[model samples]
Target: MSDKMIHAYSGDEIDVHWDKRLCIHISECVQADDPLFEVGREPWCVPDEVAKAEVREVCERCPSGALSYVDKDGTPEQPASENTGQVVYNGPLYLSGELDIEGAPEDMPGVRFRAALCRCGASKNKPFCDNSHIAAGFEDFGAIGQSGPGLDPGSAASDGPLKIKAIPDGPLKMEGRLTLKAASGRSAWQGTKTALCRCGASKNKPFCDASHRAIGFKSD
Candidate 1:
């Protein structure tokens, strides 16, 4: 996958954009709505054949932010609020609202409304979930206190840029303008600095429980 390349498919009513490098090959686009993302078909994506709303729905389901769309009517589709994230039970870290992944290539779309990040540390697509947790038998109870102090969204609002930096062989260091939520939609914490466990061994997950140190988790 070329990190700098963006493949775009323009249709009559909408345009579908894809960043191949960000795709984890979860097959959500092909499985959810095959008519638009047929693998063997010429041009592969036939956005004209499907309704604009249908195409947009599938794009939103893409966990890696590899897929996105723009309506010809000029209605904005990107999320326009504070960033938020949640820990899925025995699964990926679900993120929503406005987000900015730090250090992404200039040509790539740096911001997104939603993303399912891989927490198991087994994903072939490092940062994004490709449903590898299920295959890897990852186990987590999604406990509340394990995540640390909860942040009040109303109180933590700041104009700083949201940043997520993947440290070499370490946790995902998140800083600036973000909220961490539980599965129940309750705020777990809101802060400028939070280190999320990426090696899947954190007992205090989704926070870094220091298991990465004992397990010798190496991303590099």
Candidate 2:
């Protein structure tokens, strides 16, 4: 999907905005207790149908940062206390924390707190996942890899923004504190920086093994 803004549902207590471009249709909102978010109805999102708190809760679960809610009181969604990345089962990398995605739109709410990044190297949307992995038949068990340097148990995990830079036709260059976890929620790697494979050809799984070059992956 192309980068663009969509409709906003304004309620008395909150305003819910949808960026359809980033949505991979995870269906978190559609499954909420309220009918505020439905798939086929016209004006699919009606924030007034749900409580303000529930709207925010549903929006936060959106991995693609496609949904966001603004409280009338001026309070914004806060980033997760700990920077973390989860390798989805044969899918994108889901990140939660203060995120600084290179070249991402600055005005998109919740974009800084959550993102679903393409790891299958087939997304026409580039850095963001567009559910292209499924059609491309990308397969990975999402297992924890060799342990990397981790922060001491007593040390505080950095509460700073994780900078993600998509290298030209290469891996995702991640900087800043982050704990990369497997699908089982087990820590696989922890560090301030790492290069993650996006070409779906790395023998080392998540980590880059220079396979993109070998496969002649074209990201542009």
Candidate 3:
């Protein structure tokens, strides 16, 4: 027990459950190759292609907890058997037991792994980024008046939740817990922490789907 942790990366393989507190903003996870570290996206890693040992080695090499094993969900059960007991189902991804991500030995220790991030900007799911606003275009202004399975955008602000803003003509800018509602059908998602679109321009329906990219979405 060195009392210190390490975080390592090699090519496009891991998301590196980042610990902003312990991390110095090193660009390793943000720099690695493709499919493994899509940067600005969830599942940041493609572990199958990369080896756990190699990842461990990289972590061992880091002076910071940047690559530390805050939680090993993306990995397998056998390899990270110790982590199995800590696994907690989180709908989209598995949450490892309270391990440690940013703690410098005494702070609230915990690790986060294989998380679904918010690409759409509408995520009532805190820390968890659901790709909703993206699927819906979610204009900045549009976010002002919308309802989802577990959220009512018009009123979420009063709850001290994240706020939404149109990027001028760009994708909606959501900065807090967001929820999404059914764009159609018999309301499959009854009540779940999610995010939907306001722009109503997402090809993925209620989600943003990044169609804004093709449709020339800008918020300037």
Candidate 4:
């Protein structure tokens, strides 16, 4: 704990990125209501700004490995995982490192859902990955999903719904009893099914306008 330190940085590291695994469950970093860390959307703790002793106290309390820190020089330190030097993809966010389709949630009795989240603001089906980013030539090298809802594990439901399947190197394949919503707050629940965009390049806001294809949005 004494050896731990949190360094302060200028705005030069704006390009610094963090994914799900890197976090240390240091809820303070992500808590906007009272930002103690002041560096992230939610604040946690920064050692260099404060005292080294205080930073170690906070880091030691983390329940999950959700929080991590970077050095002043911009180099990264290893976390406490047995798997070292893994080649993590910079894009196409996967849940706990699992592919999308296998754990996708079905619309049903369960509360969880399988919807895409938008990384770029160019998605017609923003927050959901639709192929629109690709069709529209929307580029998101650091982007992932760019369309479609996240997949959940276990269970399935069927009540005359539009079925969604994952296409290889394409937008999500949806065909079933589902609805599409527009930016105007209007919704189209066409039980027939539609492929929504996860890439945020859609002029359509929430539906897959196929703009990603035109934009050439690719999830690396």
**Candidates in order: C-alpha RMSD to true structure:** 3.7, 2.3, 17.2, 14.6
For candidate 2, lDDT tens digit of each residue in 190-216?
A: 887789999999988788999999999
- TM-score (C-alpha, index-matched) for candidate 4: 0.32
- lDDT string for model 1 (68-134, tens) is 8878999767664767777888888877666776566555552356667879998877676767888
- For all candidates in order, the CA lDDT equals 0.76, 0.87, 0.36, 0.34
**lDDT top scorer:** 2
| Candidates 2 and 4, the one with greater lDDT | 2
Model 4 ranges with Cα > 4 A deviation: 1-116, 119-162, 182-187
Q: Count the backbone clashes (under 3 Å) in each candidate.
A: 2, 0, 38, 83
Pairs clashing within candidate 1 = 150-188, 151-189
- What overall lDDT, based on C-alpha atoms, would model 2 receive against the true structure? 0.87
lDDT, candidate 2, residue 211?
99
**Candidate 4 residue-wise lDDT at 89:** 20
Model 4 gets an lDDT of 0.34
Please write out the lDDT profile of model 4 over residues 13-98, one tens digit for every residue: 22112223223233544443332356543322434454433443343233222233333455443222211111112212211111
Q: TM per model?
A: 0.75, 0.92, 0.25, 0.32
Residue 116 of model 2, lDDT score: 92
Write the residue-wise lDDT of candidate 3 on 161-193 in tens digits.
233343444443444333332222122322223
- Residue 159's lDDT in candidate 3: 42
